[model samples]
Target: MKKPLLMIVGAIAVLAAAAFLYPNAPSGNAAPPGKDAKHGEKGHDEGHGAEGVVEMTDAKVAAAGIEIVTAAPATLHDSIILNGILQPNQEALVQVTPRFPGVVREIKKRIGDSVEKGELLAKIESNQSLSVYEMRAPFSGTVIDRQISLGEYASEQKPAFVVADISTVWVDLSVYRRDLPRVRLGDAILIDVGDGGDPIKAELSYVSPVGSADTQSALVRAVVANDGMRLRTGLFVSARLILSAKQVPVAVKGSALQTVENRNVVFVRSGEKFEARDVEIGSRDSENIEIVFGVMDGDKYAARNSFVVKAELGKGEASHDH
Candidate 1:
């Protein structure tokens, strides 16, 4: 009986020594605190917290095409938007006519043909003189219309060709009666040809004194130099007539603004991370917006593609929750 008792006491002492050596060892099927079988050293919510911080490396940011810019004073344009269509500069257009009533002998120019000044367009047989007369282009331009076909009559009463030098174009904008009071000649305007390109800048050259009885709108025009022939005649366009410009102390591009967690936020750059900072926005133009709060001058932020940061933050939060 004593031998058996001594053996039980020895067993109890060995178990106590093992427990002291491995005090924090994981129990069966259980992971240690702040760790899991899948999570390894840290739990799912280890790195994220209430204050939103998105960890993005420089390479990741560059790969995402996120442009960073410092908040600074910027001009906010207060402008009126107007829709219009492009037209050829009527002043630079010409109508070519035959000098005498004649029968067409040879037709050379066609619609859409480019012509040089004094270029021969056709040879005509005059009805009275029975002599061949030459029809020449009055100026260098493109033939927008050709009235006579081969062997067709070249009449003196009708134009033989409609040529226009489209080196410059007129943007014909219709101003509603209500907006006409605000628009004036010589005001600065931006012409958008809806080709996803930069808007062309020009001054308003003319404003009609009379309003159209049919549309109750007045015609306003801007002459724009057709650089690269980008402003095609008959293409629909939009214009922003500058009404006023105000300088704000702190402003950012409108693309930087984003709505996150039911609040407006701008992703501000911190070392190796971006924080979704709440912001109050004020006046905004087509390109930029005034930052009234939560951002300060000299703060570097995601000026473009800020939605990428917002998406990353959402993903982080979701992973933390899961």
Candidate 2:
């Protein structure tokens, strides 16, 4: 009876121990503290937390579209840009000055009136010498300025009417000193009169050898045929001198280039990050500039405003060093 009681007591104690330990045991095997199980849980939680933080902050970073280009041997026709005023061709502009002093009796043409060659513009009743002199239009053109009116005094040296031929117009382009080498006598030019139509094409007729000391620009004259009588003198126009050759090296938009440390640089997209690269620059048009070095063809580059990426990169570098 004593032996059986002892065996039963031991069996009960063993059962209680097994029940208590089962709850505390790991699902697979009993792992040591701070070992694989504990460490794996901690790491997984940290990983998830880090990923959440990244996702939360990613919305603030602005993204820009980028383009990949390749460098090829291209002809870069360099040019000088200048501002110029439109003037009538010398052969077409006529200033009518009276030969003798007289009193103007009648005025035939007014401002903005179109006249023909040999057309009588005004009839003057002379009182100084009692001789009547009739003023006629020298060329078929529009009257731009009328200095004399009816019954006004007309002097021999005073201009009476200013006539300008609208059949052919001149575009006086202001070429900067830097672009003087690119301008030639026969280069093609495009002139925009801001009339909401296509630009007019013309050929460069002459380039001034001397530059103006005040504006520091040379005058380049282009002659355009105005058979339709569309262009007018003194109309503010934007001129574009087209070069015969394409830009060499690689060309990118001007907005894409930025200054860093007083040097020109462009952000190149690489994988998930952008790389800052210094570049050599060349001639530039209004919208695009020539890239002399640093970028290769087919390499994706950030376009539009890329300052955000540059700031982010700067922060990243700082953080890495820290």
Candidate 3:
């Protein structure tokens, strides 16, 4: 009887120690070791934020300076990029040189001044006749350069003024021999002015049969209409010649392209919110990119400043300590 009693007291002491040591153990909802990966994946999916969907207010869109453009069918060209410089149309350019050796007496036009054809530009005292004579413009144009000043020595060898009609200009492109075979006299040339302006369209008018001594490239000239004087003489420009033309049924500006969640995407403006939509691209040119799958023609997407949407989406999906 005494032994049984001692055994019961020892059992009671063990139960008391167990209850004190393990008062708050894991419940039924507690996860197992292998279950952690499952929970982590769930959090990841939530944090990824529905792939490309980004929502914001109109005020936020305007404040972010997001620009939107309509995707549409566009005429895309396969082009060969060329480096070149803008020059005055040689047909419209004139060098006004003195006919007789003389001393400059008076000057009227300066560089960048405009004069009409047969307009008086300067007066010179003839060395032979000892009398003053006037120099007139040969063509209506802007004075691009003036090498002579008032009272300076003037002669038949020196040009008094160089004028060029900039209503049109020439884009001289350096074409490699390999490109010569593809380039034609009537091919279209797009000249990039580098001022974020529209490219000036020109047609290849001349291609030198001979190559250059320094670069081994032939000179190819394209005449472009420059009504606004956008193309300036000696201005460095990048150009491309269209080899083939094709219709891109659906296309968007390259600036609209963005990478979201490791997928090619475009921020499509849906009503008041811009949603990031996945895209499958086919072909791309210097300005426009062809859309193969994701987006459709006439769908509006963010063009300039689309990165703002990307930034906002990034902030929304930013990780937090749980």
What is the C-alpha local distance difference test score of each model?
A: 0.90, 0.72, 0.85
> Who is ahead in TM-score, 1 or 3?
1
Candidate 3 local lDDT, 1-322, one digit each (tens): 9999999999999988988998875557766443443554335455444645677777888888887789999878899999999888889989999888888999999999999999999999999998999999998989998878878789899888999999988888899888888988899877889989988787899989899889979999988888677778898899878999878899999999999768999989987777888899988887899999888878989898999888877776675223
Write model 1 residue lDDT over 1-322, tens digit each, in one string: 9999999999999989989999887889887777778866566557675568888999999999999999999999989888899998999999889999989999888988999999999999999999999989889999988889878777989999899999999999999999888887899998888889998999999999999999999999999999998878988999999988899999999999999869999999988789889999999998999999999999999978889999999988787766
Clashes of 1: 0
- Superposed model 2: Cα runs more than 4 Å off: 1-80, 128-131, 247-322
Q: What stretches of model 3 exceed 4 Å from their correct place?
A: 1-52, 150-152, 258-262, 267-278, 303-322
Rank by lDDT (best first): 1, 3, 2
TM-score for predicted model 2 compared with the true structure: 0.57
> What is candidate 3's TM-score against the reference?
0.71
- Per-candidate TM equals 0.78, 0.57, 0.71
Give the Å error, residue 102, model 3.
3.4
Instruction: List, residue by residue over 40-85, the lDDT tens digit for candidate 2.
Output: 4334344222210112122343433334333344455444344567
lDDT of 1 at 246: 97
Segments in model 1 whose C-alpha atoms lie over 4 Å from true places: 1-45, 62-65, 315-322
lDDT of 3 at 188: 85
